[model samples]
Target chain A: MERIEIGHGSGGKLTRDLIEGLFLKYFKSPELHSLQDATYLPGFEKIAMTTDSFVVQPIFFPGGDIGKLSVAGTVNDLTVSGSVPKFISVSFIIEEGFPISDLERIVSSISKTAESAGVKIVTGDTKVVEKGKCDGIYINTTGIGDVKRELSPKFVKPGDVVIVTGFIGDHGISISLSREEFEVETEIKSDCAPLNSLLVPLFDVPGLRFMRDPTRGGLATVLVELSETSGLGVRIYEDRIPVRDEVRFICDMLGYDPLYLANEGKAVVVVDRKDADRTLEILKSHPLGKNSQVIGEVTEEKGVVLVTSVGGMRRLELLEEDPLPRIC
Target chain B: MERIEIGHGSGGKLTRDLIEGLFLKYFKSPELHSLQDATYLPGFEKIAMTTDSFVVQPIFFPGGDIGKLSVAGTVNDLTVSGSVPKFISVSFIIEEGFPISDLERIVSSISKTAESAGVKIVTGDTKVVEKGKCDGIYINTTGIGDVKRELSPKFVKPGDVVIVTGFIGDHGISISLSREEFEVETEIKSDCAPLNSLLVPLFDVPGLRFMRDPTRGGLATVLVELSETSGLGVRIYEDRIPVRDEVRFICDMLGYDPLYLANEGKAVVVVDRKDADRTLEILKSHPLGKNSQVIGEVTEEKGVVLVTSVGGMRRLELLEEDPLPRIC
Candidate 1:
């Protein structure tokens, strides 16, 4: 029955109680306990920083809520960038009159996700806007990590092979069905998760050229970027790219392309051809990567081309328009 | 006439163009120029981190806009915490169809502010929500700085002097008048500014115990917090507290307490009583601190007390409700 009031974000007594009763109880870090203006941390030799804002609609999706997505999204960005995420700062913008119980639930999710990812929630801020000024809730998480290695397009060569950590388009499809706008029913759950555990170990592996999360623009967009940045071509096999039958079915029914749909928990990695099989074996050994596949390879040409099962070639371009909004 | 489309946030070609054409052009830094998933920076021995989300309405207001406020808010937090801010990460959540021209103007403001604050915009993210799902725009800024000194209540002691850098409640009054809900008009402007260049020098001054920006809950809440946290009493003179006549007139008309109102560009500093005069002189030497005053002194008693001009005593409590929202 408890509801948030404007005072909860007024940086006053109510704000203090909410932080102590909810956030402090959930995110138990020594740095946060100090409640200083800024969290002071011991610095590393080199650090990586990234930021993301999650405005996912239908806050509670099949496999994840906005809290989980917020943490996972920032952690995955650090992970794919060849860093070990160590700290995260979370800021929330909530609408007035939102349920305190729901906020607690989201806070719990953020705590669990950060724990699983081995990152600490060190500092944060909260603001409340009057009704209709904002959506239910939006979370912005900024992550800092220790840079373990340097990964860049310059290291990617023509003979490098492209590997996707797991099936693509599940997240995008799951979100679509969750909206229930199309009256379509399916049991596909979002692949929303942190990639630090699955991808951080690969930083030590030899021949890792570059890695990036296939998020908003999906696998095809990542490949196109890789090609353009490295000035090398990419040739992806349409059949080799793993897409779940349920997801593909939903995409087909909704006139969507699985290749350009978003994925929350997958990574597109480019590795030297000589180490491609080793990388695949290492990836498949992990539970989150059980469905991993080597979907394509770098080429001498200068554009992204798909080799279809019909023995025809088609070029893929960066997505021009959005089919879905606020999908994380 | 150009406006943002849903496609601009799709992480596609449009997204690339926006980043390259708009963001990159303004936020010029080597780390950002690399266009990696995360920004890599050389680490310091110790660092301070903070985050804040700005949901200020009207987008633009007298003296500053959301962009300036976003950068200054985070930078000031670091400066008050005894750090030299070095980098900032900006993230935007914009509603679809928001004017690109307005966005560019905001970006220019951010660029200028960051440049003046001597911090680099190292990394960022953007998301666009459907119409009616959000206000025009919201910004979140996270800052990382090198810790130059340790400022905490643990170092605060009885007999310390409390100094407010300038006037209070200007930002709160300015925002209220700009809303025009009461149709009151005035030339008052929001005192939204970055305080790094002004306050960072004080870190070298001896006897500086603690400092904090009197932001959302104003000087009263901050003093109450200091009293509670340090287990020391504070007795401030009402006559010494700086309040502009224009701001006071509006507050009197609106039934608002200026002490509980917000300030965007001020700091409440605690210093050893012996060094109070020297600190005041130093503060008065700066343009931003010409109105600096020794407002009160730390006491042996355990609560905040106000000595009224009429020789009566009054007590100040932590703000219980928000008189204004989104003032920053």
Candidate 2:
């Protein structure tokens, strides 16, 4: 098997060959084809920019690999921020001796994911480290998008409704099980799809106040952050929150709180009570959001409180320690 | 010493504390203060985008650290492309148990370097891996710059002059010596400085055709690339190439070619013969470019050639292997 060598990252002939033969072939865009130090993008009035680094273990997962996750992760960030992602820049730090075939597979995944997310791979960089200096590969992606709408927690009001786009905690649960630390296995895969298309239509709805992807710290963390930042209160209903049975079972067995687990492709959206039903209708119309549900509402109280099915109120605090690392 | 824990990158309370306590304190900007998923930048007609991942070993070197090198590396790429760097996104993949003090020092260096480069650190992400899965830290910076001038190898032509901004191979040599593998000692320091202020002036100079920073593959590699890409010949005189006495001494002892070693703070420029003197004068006026020299000229023949001090003609090839890795 062909393995990467230090020369492949030396920015020399080997680097050139790898780029031209592998990356350029997969990421076919005029901006990248020019092979300049920087890619020039023309005509932008207002832009949104976000970045993320993916160091998830087990490069390949059930539903997605690091390549797909990296692209979707940034795209989802921009999407939640009410931006239309346009171009993305990817950089990689690969360990020497990493398989060339694995790299090609990842590159192909990146291309396909970027295409589906409706973004162009404009520029990128690659660096290789000595064998033990790095894990197999770590990818960093920065996305640029056109600001389509202004979304902020400041717009959230006491009577606003909170809606989750899909079943929560699937991604976190899938990664945990993939580690094989527990002998339990299930068919649940990560919900690591890009939410851009599903959520873009919601930007047209009136009273759309704020949006956030429940990624690393999950739905509860995002709600807590929203409550603190907006200086408002949140009241979520435990029974209304959507979670797959398998995820809930695994979380229960592992002593994890599904509400605090990560979700790669779901968004916690706040909209006016008057437009909540309309927003839900729009979200539920998309396949990615078919499991959408109104889970909570903004309140005059000051903290994030979950009203359980048994009529008990529990306060949700920001996560103090990680239950899982590199779940993204 | 306080050390980074996996919780610090969990995107929860600990992550928030780290961001607010360190990154936000240093990277003071309204865009970052918003803490939105993405930063919004208004009013851009044309922009240049570039990304790079820095994994330089030793973390700290004589003149700069990985933090400083990361910022300067991306900023210089934009500068050479004739852009005014305006916004930068930084992401770090850190190892668990890495010293927080070291991380803070690196961040301080990054903040200082970004400020000096006239760019805003608008958005970022942090991910931590298990202790042995990664080196101390790796930084990925993607920059967005306003395009002030169009530059390309397509504009280069025969009879154009090639100018180098300063001494070659300082960064590579400094890194090699820092490794302590050769039992050598020297006062040499890496020339890891941002070149925007120095090179931005040349953008206004008429007849300037192309510019590229001689970095990973160094001056010879850059010149060879220029020759191949522009379909023009390049003939550089060894006598005209600038090299410090210490650098020359180290290279001779180590059996390394200074021409192929990396430089962090220098640019190889191609310009019209009629404006060569003016370009040289302008470059010489800057402290960073005091050692600037017109070392070669574009020729009608097809390959890169070196005219040795003894008047022997020798061809230069693109570097096939790196003499030093992670020199940044």
Candidate 3:
């Protein structure tokens, strides 16, 4: 049974062996082997660059592994930011003694995910630390994309409507249950996915002001940030926010709110009220966004207020503690 | 004294408090606070992007800490790629129960180093894992730079001269001693630094073919890689390679070759023979490169060979294994 050793990250023969044997074998791209310190990309006047480090516990989850989540996380960040996700750099810090077979599986997932999204895994690095110094592996991916439209909260106005692309909390709950720390079981799977194929086309819709994927801290944190940044209050209808029955059941049993659970494949969009219907129509046509709904609207006031299903308006404060840590 | 809890990385209120009180207080970049999922950088037709994950042990090391190394590592990667280092995205994966004061100290160091390099830490992410799941902290930085010139080994020919920017092995020896695992002591200082300001001017030099900072694998690995990539051999004079006496002594005591030790603030430049003298002179004028020297030349043969002080030629192999792990 071959396993990853500390020598694999020594930047010498073993490192080269690992790269050529595993990484290059999976990420076979010209830009990756271009023999330059930095991967060079030509022809882009303006660019959007974002980075995320994936530290999910139970590296292999129900629907996806760390590799898939790593690629999807960075790609979604760029896509939601109004950029056409093009190239990404993936770096891995693996703990020694990790099975090479698992590493290969993860790499294959990264390749498949990137190919499906039409994005290239152009550059990468791998480092192996001693056992106990790190968990199985942590992946940091930074994505660069070509800007297609302007998507900033600055364009979010008081009359704008807020829309959610799909069901939330699946990823958070899936990762949480995978740990088996709570002695619970469910068939729920992570909503981990790349959204460029779904959201990039929406740039043609007029008045599309902002789009962001709810990952850590989930939907509530993003809405709060949007409110603070736009100086406009956000009011969401609790009934309108979509949640799967299984996810809702787990949240209720655990005293966790679905609003604060992470979603790897969901988008919170803000657009002109006149364009909300059109945006929802555009989103619903995609498989990932089949449950698209107008969940809220921007208000003239200055905080996030949620209208509960019981017909009571209450403040949805920021997530104060980590109910599910390392959900990534 | 408050320590960093898992909540700080929950992407919730504690995360916001840490960002506002610590990260924003230090980073203070407009792009960082622009309230966007991905930082937007405007206007660059062609760009170089590089990413490195720093997991140096004993986070605080002699001459430089993880903060300084994180900045310099990515910035130098961009610099050697013939790019003017511009923007960087930093992500941190910290272990829970880590001291907040140490984290702040690291953040402050990052601010100072980024400022000195004229690069912006435009975006960042923080995640905290359970205790013992990771080392104290690991920082990963991805740098984006504007290409100032085309510097690649494809431009190298048989007559190219190899020039090293400064003394080698100081960083490796310093870090090795800092660990104190072997009970060896030395006064060597890590040569970690940002070299764009020092090397950017040399783009004006005629026949500047390629440049690369020798980090993890040291000069031997760089030369070997250059040989394999350019299809040319490299021959270096052992006497001509500059190594500080303290570093050499420690290497000798430990039976390690100075050529294979890591160097944080050094570069191996490949230039046409006609421009070697001029490039060396330009580099030597900078304080960080006062020991700049031309130690080798590209040969028609096809491997990396070192001429020993005893007048025997021997192969300088790629770093076989990490003699000193976490040396950065």
Top TM-score: which candidate number?
Answer: 2
Higher-DockQ candidate among 1 and 3?
1
Native contacts conserved, per model? 0.84, 0.85, 0.84
lDDT of 3 by residue, B1-328 (tens): 3798999999888988998899998897898988466878886878989998999988998899999999999999999999999999999999999999999999999999999999998888998998999999999999999988988887889979999998999888888888877665556788999998889999999899989999888999999999988899999999999988878778889888889899999999999999888898899899988899999899999999999989999997787798887876
| After superposition, candidate 3 runs with Cα above 4 Å error | A181-185, B181-185
Candidate 2: where are CA atoms >4 Å away? A181-183, B181-183
**Global CA lDDT of candidate 1, please?**
0.91
DockQ of each: 0.83, 0.86, 0.83
Better of 2 and 3 by TM-score: 2
User: Can you write out model 1's per-residue Cα lDDT over A17-56, one digit (the tens) per residue?
Assistant: 9999999999999999889879999878999999999999
For residue B42, model 3's alpha carbon misses the true position, in angstroms, by 1.2
lDDT of 3 by residue, A1-328 (tens): 3899999989989988898888888887789978466978876978988999999989999999999999999999999999999899999999999999999999999999999989887777788899998999999999999988978888989989999998889999898888876756678999999999889989998899999999998899899989888888999999999999999999998888899999999999899999888888889999998999999899999999999999999897788798999987
Give the alpha carbon lDDT tens digit for every residue of B1-328 in model 1.
2999998888898889999999998999889888887989898899999999999977898889999999999999999889999999999999889999999999999999999999999999999988877788999999999999999987888999999999999999888888877666678889988998888888888899999999998999999999899898999999999999989899999989999998989999999999898888888898999899999999988899999989799999998778897776
Worst 10 residues of 1 chain B by lDDT: B177-186
Interface RMSD of each: 0.9, 0.8, 0.9
- Candidates 1 and 3 compared: the better one by lDDT is 1
Instruction: Report, to 2 decimal places, the DockQ of model 1.
Output: 0.83
Q: Of the candidates shown, which would achieve the greatest lDDT relative to the real structure?
A: 2
- The residue-by-residue lDDT of candidate 2 on A1-328, one tens digit each, is 2999998899998999999889998998899999898999976899999999999878888799999999999999998898999999999999999999999999999999999989999999999999888889999999999999989999999999999998999888888888877777588888999999999999999899999999999999999999999999999999999988888888889999999998888999999999998998999889998899999899998899999989899999999888998887
TM-score, cand. 3 vs. native: 0.98
